[model samples]
Target: MPRIACLHTFDSNAAVFEEALRATGLAGVSLQHTVRADLLAAAEREGRLTSDIAEETVAVLRGLSAQADAVLLTCSTLGPAAEAAAPDSPVPVLRVDAALAAEAVKAGGRVVVLCAVETTVEPTRHLFEAAARATGAAVSVEVVPQAWAAFKAGDPERYRELVARAAGAAKAAGATRVALAQASMAGAAALLPETERPLTSPTVGLAAAVAASRG
Candidate 1:
């Protein structure tokens, strides 16, 4: 069994991400609330990540990887830090969006990165571009930054609606596929069943990636 150590910034994402792993038929999941929200908050406020903050996230990863075969980082804000830490980790440390980015590039030319948070937008776009480069795909990114408010207000219905509207806008902008940047946005993706464009979720991507890593 591949014991996945899921590192999360918010407690809210734990249940949803664990359920995603279960849906993938991999039950060996350990969720950890890395109380490093301050680093993310600072990163969001500064519009860039500093080494000290990234190191804080890496420190959390180091402490959690002792008994696990893989680590899944569910927060996009910490993605760059996760990637930076992977080289020194004892096991594979994966950003949840890794699979989603690869899938988006494989499926479409114009990839729209739909993010609820401002800080996550650039990291996600960079990941998609990296994936696109690997696939030799010419891709352009369109970012939609309008769902974080509903999320912060603790309104699920409005949150989903905002995300759904962003999805519609991405399709209208000629996006071949859309990738939700946050785990919280997965609920929004669920509510968008009638969406004409292909949408990707980190929850689904992370589960699939961890399952494959076990093989």
Candidate 2:
């Protein structure tokens, strides 16, 4: 069994990814959660990530790494910090969004990345574009600020509603595919109308990352 450490945002709990892993029959793997309100709050304030926050996040991952075979940072805004933490880790470290971005580029070119948080959007866009470039695909990314607000306000129903609304706009914006940038937006994909468009979520990405790292 692989030991996996999941670093999450202050607003979320490990239950989100725990359910995803359970569904995958990967329950044998040890899963741990690390939550830091300060780091998450810092990201929310700056509308972008800072190296200091990245360093502080690394401290959390480092602690978890001591007991796990791999680490997965569940927050999209912390992707850069996650990447920075990897080289120092004893095991592999995966940014939750990177795997989804890779999958999105593989699934479609005109991809739309939707994030609930303002700080998460640009970082997610950068990761998606980098992944698309690697796949030789072109992408168009957009940030939906309102989506994050709904989720942060402790309303999952409103969050899903906003996600569907944003997905519709993404479709109109020439996005043949949509990638929900945060783990909180996972099931929101189901809200989209049936069409040629495909919706991607971080749940699958996190699962894949854990599997790969464990292997």
Candidate 3:
């Protein structure tokens, strides 16, 4: 069996990422979950990247990489840390946002990349822009910081409510599609009306990583 490591921080649970992996139905692949509350708290407090946090996170990934065929980091705030961990890993390290970014680029002009946290917003924008540039797609990315605060506050209903509002704002801003920046936002996206705008989630990216790692 192939093993994949999923690294997460406090805003999301490992199960959400694992559920996406299970939905893929790929044989001989299992996921290992790693969580670091301190790292999450630090990122939330600083609202930006720090070398210390990055180093701690990379240490976690290094431990996981020893046992897994591939790794995926679910926290958008720690994306730089995840990337820094990648080059040194014995296995491939997949950024959870990568697939969603690619999907957003493919969705074409004026793509709205919605995120729940302030720290996540800019990093996600950078990811989307990179993806859009690579794909030759003209796009616009917006960060919805309030959504994450609501979700972290433990009100699922409120999270849904905020996501709808964010989606509406994105549409008004000329976004043809919406991409959820975190795996935890999948449920919130489902609550929104399905119309001309398409919704992209991180689940598909995790699934793809699981499959690629298995092969």
Candidate 4:
């Protein structure tokens, strides 16, 4: 079995990301999760996240690496730390947003990167811009800054409602797809109609990336 470690900035809720991975029914795959709200707090204070926290985060990854084949970062905020640690880490490391960002680019035209946390907007925008640039695709990012509070307050219903409203606005604004910037926003995608442009979530893409890295 190939073991995969998913790193997160939230204190818990890793299982939410793993569901789609397990749904694949690709037997003999082990999944592990590591949570560090400290990283998220640091990002909030620093105004941005980068290699600055690599020392501590890398140590965490190192510990997980001893027992896993690869590590996947599930938080957009600390994804850069994973990118920084990948070069020296004992195992392969990947930012979950990578695949989602690429998908955003492929979705074409304007991409709305929706997030509950206002601080996450810019970093997520940069991720999407980089992906769009890599594929020679021209795309613009739009932000929905109203839902984070609800998620933080433990009011998922209100959070989902805000996200759904954002999706409607995104459609009206000519967005080809709405990319849920935070992993937690993944649930918002489900609230939309199936025929909509489609809201892309990172869970499945991140899981697939980890599975592919096993080779």
Candidate 5:
């Protein structure tokens, strides 16, 4: 079985990936998880991803690459670090949101990218805009108000509900595609009706990582 090293900024994300793996029918792949909440905490404290934080994230990604067939970075805030580390890594280092952004841009129209946290807004916007550049897809990002608070308060039910509402509203407002910008927000996709369901990262990112592992 291929070994996938998953680097997550939140401990809660590990379970999100586990569930996503099963949903993607890649449960047979071996997953090695490393959770480093402090990495995101430092970024949140600084109000941005500092140079030192990026370096430390790269170091972690490089280290994980050595032990697994592929490395997947599951935090959107730290996603740029994965791109920085990928060229030097022996194995493919995949950024979860990158895959999500790519898929969102493929529809070639108005894409509304939803993020729960303030810290993720800019990074998520940049990721999707970069992905949209080539395809001429118009990308816009919106932060789901108060959704992150519910997530931090350990009320996943409320978090998903809020996120789902934001997505549904965006779709009703004329968004051609709605993309959930974080792996943690994946559950919100299930909460929305099928017609309004948003595209999410975890499952798509895991499948891309597994395919990369094979090569």
Candidate 6:
């Protein structure tokens, strides 16, 4: 079995990947998780990803790379660092939102990226915009602070409810495709209707990571 090491910014995200792995039915794939909540806390405090923070994330990935077939960074805010470290790592370092962005842009229309955390908004917007550049898809990012607050307050049901509402509003406003920018927000996608369900990082990202590991 190919082993994919997952780097997460939240302890809850470990379960997100676990559920995603099971849902994908990638039974042959194995996962190793490393959660460093401080990385995200630091970024949130700084209001942006700092050079030092990126370096710290890279150091973690470098260590994980030695033991796993691939490393997957499951935080959208730290995605750029994963892209930066990919070239130097022994194994592929995949950003969780990258595959989701690609898939959203593939729809070739107005795509809205919904982020619960403020720090994730810009990185996710840029990611989807870059993915849409060649495809002519329009990309927009919206940050749902209330949902983030709910999540931080340990009210997960309220958090998912808020996220789902925001997604529905985006769709009603003419978003042809919607992408939830964080792995933690993946549960909200389930609350949406099957036809309007938004693209989320965990399922797509894990599948992409596993594929990269095999290759």
Which has the greatest lDDT? 5
Query: In model 1, what lDDT does residue 16 have?
Result: 78
Stretches of model 3 off by over 4 angstroms after superposition: 196-198
- On residues 82-131, what C-alpha lDDT tens digit does candidate 4 reach at each position? 77778887778877777788877784576767776756777677788888
Model 5 Cα lDDT, one tens digit per residue, 1-215: 89999999889899999999889987569899999999999998998888999999999999999999999999999888999999999999999988899999997999999998888888888888988999999999999999989998999999999999999999999999999999999999998789889999999999999999999
RMSD of each: 2.4, 2.1, 2.2, 2.2, 0.9, 0.8
What ranking emerges by TM-score with the best candidate at the front?
6, 5, 2, 3, 4, 1
Error in Å for residue 52 of model 6: 0.6
Query: What would the TM-scores of all predictions be?
Result: 0.87, 0.89, 0.88, 0.88, 0.98, 0.98
Task: Compose the digit string of candidate 6's lDDT tens values, residues 1-215.
Answer: 89999999899999989999999999888899999999999999999999999999999999999999999999999999999889999999999999998999996999989999999988888898899998999998999769999999999999999999999999998999988998999899889889888888899999999999988
Q: Residue-wise lDDT of candidate 3 within 1-215, one digit each (tens)?
A: 77878888853567676667666676677777888778878988998767888898889988888888888887877887777888888888877888778877785667777777777766777787888886676655556656666777788788867876787777777776777777677766566567733465556767767766766
Better of 1 and 3 by TM-score: 3
lDDT at residue 163 of model 1 (Cα atoms): 82
Query: Any runs in candidate 1 off by more than 4 Å, and if so which?
Result: 27-35, 136-145, 194-198, 212-215
Q: How displaced is residue 198 in candidate 4, in Å?
A: 3.6
Q: lDDT of each prediction vs. the true structure?
A: 0.72, 0.76, 0.74, 0.72, 0.93, 0.92
User: Over the full model, what C-alpha lDDT does candidate 2 score relative to the true structure?
Assistant: 0.76
Off by over 4 Å in 6: none
Angstrom error of the Cα, residue 77, model 5: value is: 0.3
Kindly report which residue pairs in candidate 4 clash with one another: 116-148
State which candidate, 3 or 5, has the greater TM-score: 5
Error of 6 at 6 (Å): 0.4
lDDT of 2 by residue, 1-215 (tens): 77777888854557777777766676577677777767878977876788888888888887788888888888888888878888888888888888788888985467777777778777887888888876667776666657767777788888887877888877787776777888877767677767833455446665766676657
Model 2: clashing residue pairs? 116-148
Q: Could you tell me which 10 consecutive residues in candidate 6 have the lowest summed lDDT?
A: 120-129
